[model samples]
Target: MSTASTKKPPEVRLPPKPDLELRLDKFAQLATIFLSLVGLLFVLKTGSFLLAPVSLAIVVGLMLAPVALRLEDIGLPPSLSAAAVVLIFVLVTGSIAAAIAAPLASWAARVPQIWNELQLQLQLTSFSEPLATIRSVREEIRNVTGEPNVTVSVQDGSPVESVAVLAPALLAQVLIFFASLYFFVATRHDTRLAILKMCSGRRIRWRAAHVFRDVEGLVSNYLLSIAIINIGLGVTVAVVLWLLNVPSAPLWGAIAGVLNFFIYIGPALMAVILLGVGLASFDGMPGILLPPLAYLALNAIEAQIVTPMTIGKRMTLNPFIIFLAVAFWLWIWGPVGGFIAIPALLILFALARNLIPGFPWGMPEERRRRLSRLP
Candidate 1:
């Protein structure tokens, strides 16, 4: 009897099961989120004609919003504020176009001459191997595919016809961009209030407010800071190149400033362009390398020193994330994708901080500092 009593085990305890309705609700929520994301990406990829302009407009508007707000604070109407911002933007763009249009056209005119020089130089140097490998690969592919020795030619259309074909689409995009930008700026307050009102609870409204504020502040401040830094970079490059006797130094500087916005890819492309320009404009290997090398040095200073001091980590994103965003958008919409990638990241991260629990994006200074101290 004693042994039997001792053999009795403690009463077993079981945890309460999750409610079926609650589990089902969570699954439904997750599924809805997944489907919404898929649909959004599909629309973005397929609707570039409309979406790209809208996206660019939104980013531009976001950046210009502070100006609009300042104007409003100064007793200007919303419409007037939006108009002033847009007009200023137009003038800035026009100035940039005027600066580079002639140089770009001249370069385009010299492409054949440049190509001839490049070929001649390559033959006399050790840099032709890569091109030779490409040709050899082409021959191998032709052999594999049994290619026909047919020559196909494309006829150049009249300039008028080309313009006629192109102008409407470009005009449409411009109009859409202007319209979206104007409306977005004009409705800034109304839009924010509407967003808050749409949220069902006080917590959600507060989060929405944070997201709206952060997105506007992050995109505007980052763009403004970078633009200021790039302006300095452009002026530095222009001065350096002018001293170095590079033709169209200002144009190259302008190009550099614009391309620097693309981060790594822009600089590499700029280096290659400068290399070609140097080779075309000067003689000997040393002369050919000077411009690009100088640019690389200046770029190093800006990227390493100026940008970090100016931008800090307030809106700093992982390079991998930016690269992927650029690559993804590039696949969808080419150059426009590259321009919007950073802005898109800023907006997404701003929203993520407010919407996603335990997520690290747009983290506060204290939290970020704590993270930096971790192993």
Candidate 2:
């Protein structure tokens, strides 16, 4: 009894609880974003062969969706409506291509002569020192790398052989593109339903629905509006070019119309091209400056006046953000990247708005802290 009484009570221990501080799980979120970006870049780079066409088709399909919707409202079957829309799109594209082809061919044939003339003209300029410096730097890099003194002579295949080699892949991309567009248009409702099904609650479903509708409406309307404006820009340029007696006015107009979709850089590039062509075609500074200057004026009006009035201030994006998006995508995928960049930005903007509800873009400190409260 004495020995039992002398024994001390058993030692007790408990697992420590984590601190329940009111801090955001910033590390986890940052890691998730980082990983997601890495994965996206990998897929984009590796699957570019398939993904580029698919992306283009999706953007095109979104633009054509209203036609399909209107047809459906008139009691056409979804498949039939989608088919009709796709057919119309194809016809329009083909017609434009046909219209531009002859002029483009003519311009292409003149490129060598233009290049020669440009070189001759530039020789009397201050550019010679920079060119020599560039050559010297290139040689230095070559010597440092211990590169072989190799001349790569491109083996010129027959045109027929080149076409044969390229045709299958090009054909496949076209098929995939059309197929994706048709399916997306026909099954849009199903896609929406599937998205909603992934959500567990009414609130989530509602938000998802809202996001889907917002994406569809914003993307389609923005694209349509931009298309109309761009068409007008092209027509104006064509008329002006014709008045100026530019040899391939239609081709330049078409090029301007397409390139204008890529903001800032596109117009600058078009100006450069026009300037080069001007130099090639005309003798003096007045003749050389006219086309690009006229274009600049027209573009300024369209950008500053027409677009804002049409697209609305609400739809406008930050110039810095747009520039970054364009640069990033262009570095990754060239022209295709540029084409998708704005649409992608719109989609992301829509998503961010939906996710955070009234979060200001240039978020202040207090607002930034509120991101933790985002649904």
The candidate scoring highest on TM-score is: 1
What are the runs in model 2 whose C-alpha is more than 4 Å off?
1-29, 124-164, 263-269, 300-312, 361-375
Q: In terms of lDDT, which candidate is strongest?
A: 1
lDDT of 2 by residue, 22-67 (tens): 1346666887999999999998888877998888888888888889
lDDT of 2 at 149: 76
lDDT for residue 278 in candidate 1, whole number 0-100: 89
Candidate 1 ranges with C-alpha deviation above 4 Å? 1-36, 103-107, 128-148, 154-160, 300-312, 361-375
Instruction: Provide the global lDDT of candidate 1 against the true structure.
Output: 0.86
Worst 10 residues of 1 by lDDT: 366-375
RMSD of each: 7.9, 7.1
Candidate 2 clashing pairs, residues 3+ apart or interchain? none
Give one digit per residue, the lDDT tens place, for model 1 in 38-114.
Answer: 99889988899899999999999999998999899989999889899999999999988887886799897887887
